[model samples]
Target: MKVGVVTFPGSLDDVDAQRAVRLGGHEAVALWHGDHNLQGVDAVVLPGGFSYGDYLRCGAISRFSPVMTEVVEAAGRGMPVLGICNGFQILCESHLLPGALVRNQRQKFLCLDQRLRIERTDTPWTAAYAEGQEVVIALKNGEGSFVADTETLDRLEGEGQVVARYLGENPNGSLRDIAGVSNERGNVVGLMPHPEHSVEELCGTGTDGLGFFALATLAAEVFA
Candidate 1:
């Protein structure tokens, strides 16, 4: 399986995302934001980073990139797409997933090992997890609060689209502690945590984040 990680201007975690994909036993394809194609990747990952310097809202500008044009089309056609942190914001800005990420309620940047409860494991990026499992991953952001209207929230809950939720604390004041969500078909997933940073054993953080990359690769196999 080959996973493509996109690199936009100011993208800070593309290399780490690529590393995690390789560690998960897949070839990592480097993708540039200016490219007008996907380069035949089996799956795509939009890593955490300050795209376009977070101008006019975190992911607003990057959502219009040429790469996103391909990403959106591929995603609509059922290609699996995972968005992390600012990437999550990009997903929302692109309307690939419902809801929006706003500035943290505390109005400051936060960095911590966040505990997230697995809510749904059917999504392409979450198949490696079990229901109700609590996993810790690195989370850092200033505008990571997730919000949506009550009706959409209800729809997400009713449809089992909420993928993960904060276990101990709602770090950014996200509604119902939502840490991640998936689209209707479960092919697109967006989250505010960095799973790539916890895939190493010596890092002392458990390899909870590795499941995403592993599952993404496994999903590619299944699709193949």
Candidate 2:
């Protein structure tokens, strides 16, 4: 599988995301945000980081990058698009996924290995996980709170669009403890946690995050 990882002006985790893709037995394609090309990648991963130095509300500015035009189109065509952390924010900002990411309730940047429950494994990025499975992944961000209106929240829950939820405690006060969500098509997913950071067991967070990449490969194989 060829997974494209987008790099923006201030992206901080592109390297790690690329490494994770390679570690998952796939080629990692480096994509520039300014480029209007996808390089024919099978799947795409929007890695976490402070794009545009988080100058205009995390991923607000980066959502308008030229590459996003192609991304939005591809994703709409049912191609898998996994957005992590800041990428999640961009997905929301782009309206590919619903809701907005606001500042953490504590008003501080947090970095830790977070426990998450796999609420829905039907998406492109979570097929390897069993429903209700608990996995730990590293999460780091200042503006990571996920917010939406009551009706939207109800719809997400009612439709089973909520992909993952925080276990034990909510980290950023995300509404309903939502750690991840997927679009109605299931091809586009946005998650607040950094699964790429936990792909290596040596990193101490364990390799549970590898399930996400492995799941992507499985989904591609199943569909192709």
Candidate 3:
């Protein structure tokens, strides 16, 4: 399996994301934000970062990158796309997933090994996880709060599109404790946690985050 990780002007986690893909037994392809092609990768990852110096707004400017044009088109065709942290913000800004990411309720940057419950495992990126399993992954962001209207929140909960939820306590005050969410088709997912950062065993943290990149083993069927 091949996973493409896009690098934007100010992307800081592209390297970690690529390493996670390689650690997951998949070919890691470096993709540029300005590129016009997707390099025929099986899946794509929008790594977390302060793209464009977090100008205008987090992920607001990066969403208009040339590569996003292809990404949006590919997602429309049901390709698996995973967005982490700032990438999640971009996904929301692009309207690929419903709702919006606002500043944390506490109005401060937070970094922690967050506990998340797997709400749904049918998505390609989460097939390795069991439903209701609690896994810890690195969570870091400022504008990580997930917000949506009452009706939209009900729809997400009713339809089971809420992919993951914070366990114990909400880190950034995300509405309904939503740590992650998927589109109606489940091919596109966006999460406020940084799963790529915890994939290395030598890093001291457990390798529980490897599930995000494990999609290579099952993504073929999902993409097909």
Q: Worst ten-residue run, lDDT, model 1?
A: 215-224
Each prediction's Cα RMSD?
A: 1.4, 1.4, 1.5
Number of backbone-clashing residue pairs for each candidate, in the order shown: 0, 0, 0
Model 3 TM-score is: 0.96
Score candidate 2 by lDDT: 0.89
lDDT of 1: 0.93
Write one digit per residue (lDDT tens) for candidate 2, span 48-143.
888998887888899899999999999988889999998999999999999999999999999988999999888868888999999999888888
For 1-224, candidate 1 gives per-residue lDDT tens digits of 87999999999999999999998988999999999999999899999989999999999999999999999999999989999999999999999999999999999899999999989899879999998999999899999999999999999999999999998878999998999999999999998999998899888377989999896545656768
Tens-place lDDT per residue, model 3, 1-224, is 88899999998999999999998888999999999899998789999989999899888898999999999999999888999998999899999999999999999999998999989898998988999989989899999999999999999999999999999878899999999999998989999998898887788258989988999546567457
**By lDDT, who's the top model here?**
1
Candidate 2, superposed: residue stretches over 4 Å from native: 216-223
Can you give the TM-score per candidate against the true fold?
0.97, 0.96, 0.96
Candidate 2, residue 102: Cα displacement in angstroms equals: 0.3
